[model samples]
Target chain A: MANTGSNQVPTADVASVASSPRPYLPGDLAMWFFILAELTVFAIFIIGFAVTRQLYPDMFQQGQTYLHPVAGGINTIALISSSCLVALSLNAIKHSRQNYAAALLGGALLTASVYLAVKSWEYNELIQQGFGLSTNTYFTLYFFITAFHFMHVILGMIILGSMAFKTTKGAYQGKSLSGFESGACYWHMVDLVWIIIFPLLYVIN
Target chain B: MKPFGKMEYCWWTLIGITLFNTFLGEQFSSSALVSILVALTVMFKGLMIIDHFMELRHAHRYLRLMMRAYLIFFPSLIIVTTFL
Candidate 1:
């Protein structure tokens, strides 16, 4: 394999590629922009939640009382731990340690499963208590935000799981860190969103 | 070419810190101060994810700049809209 001085292709080729206006690579600038747009959408929802909370602080507080902070906190730990595993997996890929990467990815996947299980338990408890999405505006927003995050977590898991499979198959043998890098970036975004959501919804009361 | 050294230590340290903060945040709801502290802890966790996990520390300068901008602008926009 040719050792390019930097990870990026040479400047001359970059200029030519830029001048042609070719589409960015998958998981490139456009993808990042798409992620940013998604982030903006979630931010708007959060702002809406904040405004509603400001308007009816007591009801929002009451809604918080119904939430299981211990469970929520446990979920936070789970996600954080999963994020760490994903990060370690990427590091393993970088070092060409395929087996280590596979192991880390397995750990991450397990953590995701645990996250879903805990979330299911929490949802079950809330549903039993008649505090579901239809319960109130706060519950509505709560479910919406968390459900959106859950979808991302599932997607991240799929992506990481696929990467893990490929790693075991020697797909990333040399000079291809993009797959792991992209997965890490995506998983970090997943973890970051949870960090914001946990504080805004659970701890701030 | 592992992006980070001390992988196991870093991973466990971050997990420990997050769990500690989460427990403290949930158990004691005496003041907003605790909430802020918890948020800061989460923020630190985020920094670790970006720097070590995402290998942003090893990323190109332009990419790093873009990520930093996104992190700042998105949250700031939300906070401002909340007040408005």
Candidate 2:
């Protein structure tokens, strides 16, 4: 169906799909399904968090003041950086650099690890002050929402970690980078969710 | 394979905008305007990741449409529930 005929017959389909900016998507289609489904769940949770915050504005405001915005902000930057590394890893694999892609994935994993460490510190402080999940409306939503995203970050890291191992194993050569793309897509979703969470819970007091 | 592609550029932009948003939110803590600005910043950052880092800029028409729809839908939820 591709009449342009790039002359590279073996990779013609992929090249055609890549060249056409429409009617085709990147990576495995099933992964997109999962990404959309996960996003829908988080969207509902976020809206719920907002409605509850509206109901108890004073509680949310007070909770926000007690929490450390700097930690959240730093985690935001860390996740953003990790997502960037994931994107770079995808690019590296696209250019047929398996080792380079693995290295980039390792970097992404390290950045995410840092985010979790800082988050654990924040959780420790909150728990020390007796702000458990049952503390109040504000702390309840805060812990639940952030914890949900926190788990996703760990899952993203696991996916990235496996991708790194496979890349190092030479599983994804020039045209077989779908696995890496799928992992990167999920990582970016984690980052996107936190982008909203940061402003809503931490900044918008 | 450029050393610094558009994705890197988009990442840097996300960082700068996020820091600016934090500064504005802190500076205008009492003003009603900061919430709107924060919502907008959140939306913008989501869009940047969807379109650039996720490489959906060249995705299928419906996929691109749906992702952008969520970007607007979710962030607008935040803004709406905040003010109304």
Candidate 3:
């Protein structure tokens, strides 16, 4: 573990301060602030979706019926499984198991790839069936929400890709885990948003 | 602190619950009972990810509270506006 002390502090003071419990936020506080802001915007979007659904019940229901719930469900599992691998990767790094951590991060990247591929397939099908964003209010909202989320997934994959590389280099060990945790936090937020999105756009009628 | 052993278990549990929620939604699409159940399931899944996957279980009190609020507020809004 890296010493949780400043060079100016004496050795005895450093030891005592390290032993004392202090509340700490995971990752960078700035990252947490970013996450909170991101979530707030998503919440607004979801609320707007709900309100629109209320106004156009028949159109929303009809649009939802055309969607493939099974595809959405499969993607849900993929993202959640990827999230598990990300969390497990952090666990491995915490134990200084660099190879294991790299392997787990690799697994997470694969699962994320699966999610993107499945999403692409779904989008292809939608377009092939002539369901463009201008199809209707429901399709507009659906395409917008999902495509926006799709971008986030891609961004997350990029972050995980770098983290995996760093893990193989043994860069994130012990007190150096905040970067890894921050990446995981962002990935989990993607999964969290999808958890609600899947049901809202796919399952609910 | 079994050091990550429990995480895989939590992962599987999340998968099982999510699958179960999908099953409920499919079986009872028009049932008010299922709507409430589905909303609750979404909230539960979000909480699990925030607490376990995100490690908010060890986070500061304000952070934990903020997450809790997000988990509750959004799902409740969805249920009220859509189901009711």
Ranking by TM-score: 2, 3, 1
lDDT at A71, model 3: 78
Give the clashing residue pairs of candidate 2, or none. Answer: none
Superposed on the true chain A, the predicted chain A of model 1 yields a TM-score of 0.85
- Top TM-score hit: 2
Please give the TM-score for the first chain of candidate 2: 0.90
Candidate 3 local Cα displacement, residue A31, angstroms: 1.0
- Native-structure RMSD, model 3: 4.5
Q: In candidate 2, what are the lDDT values of residues B1-84, reduced to their tens digit?
A: 567557778888899988887676566573457777777888889899988788777677788999899888877876676557
lDDT of 1 by residue, A9-33 (tens): 3222222423443332313444456
Model 1: CAPRI class: acceptable
Badly placed stretches (over 4 Å) of model 3 are A1-20, B1-3
lDDT of 2 at A158: 91
| DockQ by candidate, in order | 0.37, 0.67, 0.58
Error (Å) of candidate 1 at residue A4 is 9.8
The per-candidate count of clashes, in order, stands at: 0, 0, 0
Point out where model 1 deviates above 4 Å. Answer: A1-27, B1-6, B69-84
Q: Which lDDT tens digits does candidate 2 get at residues A1-205? A: 1222222222323346567644555566788899999888888888888888778888888888877777888899999999999888876776677789899999999999999999999999999888899989888888889999999999998999999998898887644455566778889989998998888877887
- Shift of residue B60 alpha carbon in model 3, Å: 1.0
Per-residue accuracy of model 1 over B4-42 as CA lDDT, tens digit each? 555567677777876676676568763655654655565
Global Cα RMSD, each model: 5.9, 3.6, 4.5
